[model samples]
Target: MQDRAEETRRAVLQAAAHLFFERGYAATSINDISERSGRTSGAIYFHYTNKEQLALAVVEAHFAAWPALVAHHEAALEPTLRKLVRLSFAVARAFRDDVLVRAGARLWAERRSIAVEMPPPFVDWIATVERMLTQARVEGDLAPHAEPSRDAPTLVAAFFGLHTLSDALDDRVLIEDRLADLWLLLLPGLQSCPAPRALLAEVGAAPRARRAAPTP
Candidate 1:
């Protein structure tokens, strides 16, 4: 009975994520989710009290699954900057393929409608980038003048803009190319020593080997 209940909950979240991604939160309805999942209204209400709660669930699920996706590619020890670059590619691929991610991205714009204050994805992302930048500074991967505290937010905002453009254009490859171009443009000023041209070239290359598996 417990397993069956869990399955029902998963099905509702999956259906809701897809609906929310295709149509913004205000446009989606409880009936829409129910219809998509082939579950009764009672089943969805069992897991989520309302559409707002369901939308929050989708965002929570998106972030909850992200660490595993990053960890999958980060198993081997590598240069800090290289790791950061690889993670960006992995995230882009995930954004392209994962409906949960798309839902979360869509939900971010509609967060004002959500009653509860959920964990903000932008804050989480900035913190993650800050940690990576701090460590890179410690390891002398970054230039002497490059301050992680200042650069972290900048990088996060820039990447967010790039990702937003990708979503608008519906061309993930273009964002990947733009990110590689961004690295090439910034690395010279950011790296302690001359940035590896090869690293810039390699961004969005073969690193999809650890492509994130879609969350069920």
Candidate 2:
């Protein structure tokens, strides 16, 4: 019974995430979630109580996913700067591909409409970037002028702005390419050392090979 209940809850959350991604908070209803989940209204109410609570759950789940992503990279032996760059790419991929992340982003953008207080967006992200930048500085990889305290928020804002623009223009299919462009432009200003060619290639920012000199 417990396992079945857990399964039902997962189903409901997945359904809610899809609806929220497709339709903003005000447009999505408990009935819509029920229809999508194929679970009765009473069953949803038994678990979620109301649309507001369900929205909050979906948003919370979205935030919950980040730590594991960070942990996975942290376990890898890499420079802090490289980890930060790769982490941004990983998050961009999630924004492009994960329904829950899309729902959470939309819900966050539309949080004012939701009656219940939702967790503030971007604060944790900024903090994470700041920590990574500070570590990069300690590792002597950050440019001398780069101040983590000042730069972290800027980096986070640009990263999300790229996603927002990509989503608006092309439903985020171009997000990874946009991110690569951003890094190619910003790396020189942020790093004291040249970013590894492998790292640049990983995010698709690698420079093109020079054309062979024309035979005389």
Clashes of each: 0, 0
lDDT (C-alpha) at residue 14 in model 2:
97
TM-score for each of the candidates: 0.87, 0.91
Candidate whose TM-score is highest: 2
User: After superposition, which runs of candidate 2 have C-alpha atoms over 4 Å from their true positions?
Assistant: 196-198, 202-216
Please give the CA lDDT of all the candidate structures: 0.80, 0.88
Off by over 4 Å in 1: 72-75, 171-173, 202-216
Clashes of 1: 0
Which ten residues in a row are the worst by lDDT in model 1?
A: 201-210
* Cα RMSDs, all models: 7.5, 3.7
